[model samples]
Target: MAVQTYSGSCHCGNVRFEADIDLAEGSGKCNCSICSKTRNWSVSVKPEGFRLLSDEQATTDYQFNTQSVHWPFCRTCGVRAYGHGDIPEVGGKFVSISVACLDDVTPEQKAALAVRYADGGNNNWWNEPSDAEKQYL
Candidate 1:
């Protein structure tokens, strides 16, 4: 209900992390090429609120577009559970956490979450997704 630490990991459990996330603050879906392809529904948190709990060496970073964000995934399982970036739009350092990767979330808790939509595919990072896109996202 409030900001609390949540455990998350990549599919193979090779990359693990903990983040202080407040679901009431909301989560989001981005209609960008990468996000759309991966279906990366996420929550944004300050970098200080995220901590890597496993081997960093077990993961690899993938960057594209302006190359401002580091999308890290488990090398073994290829699941991108979280990423970090320093972007002005988010007040400097931020960690983008994959909601699907969270370990202990309940169906009720997930249903209670507010969902924000972004039209990232058109380079509109903070705008709403198109109606047609919304249905799928």
Candidate 2:
């Protein structure tokens, strides 16, 4: 897949970031409580591939479950542009960038994305999002 740089930020622009992403690789949406409530649409980018352009102090953290993921929201705008967490498989941390926050992608680009809905609401992250994939197809 080809690579592209995406710049995004919170609704109020208090929290911002840039990431190198391949939109063809698709993105993720979870049925988890917070996600379901916020309708978060996201793509994963490695630490090196992601850059935060805003002050860390501009955001506030909210966590649940095992507290592995830190859901940061811009205090001023109440928008969660991204989330941070460590992955056991990668032996490192990762950033989940909100696709809706992206400033440059066109609506067509967004519509073309293949999204997988994880059953995170049930803690069944191990299983493939089969039903959701089928629906998209």
Top TM-score hit = 1
The reply for model 1, stretches above 4 Å from the true place, is: none
What ranges in model 2 sit over 4 Å off? 89-92, 128-137
lDDT per residue for candidate 1 within 1-137, as digits (tens), equals 67999999998898999999988999999899988999988999998899999988999889998899999889999999998889887689899999999998777888888899999899898799888998887
Per-prediction TM-score to the true structure, in the order listed = 0.95, 0.88
Per-candidate Cα lDDT values, in order, are 0.90, 0.85
Q: What number of clashing residue pairs does each candidate have, in the order they appear?
A: 0, 0
Output the TM-score of candidate 2. 0.88
Q: List the residue pairs that clash in candidate 1.
A: none
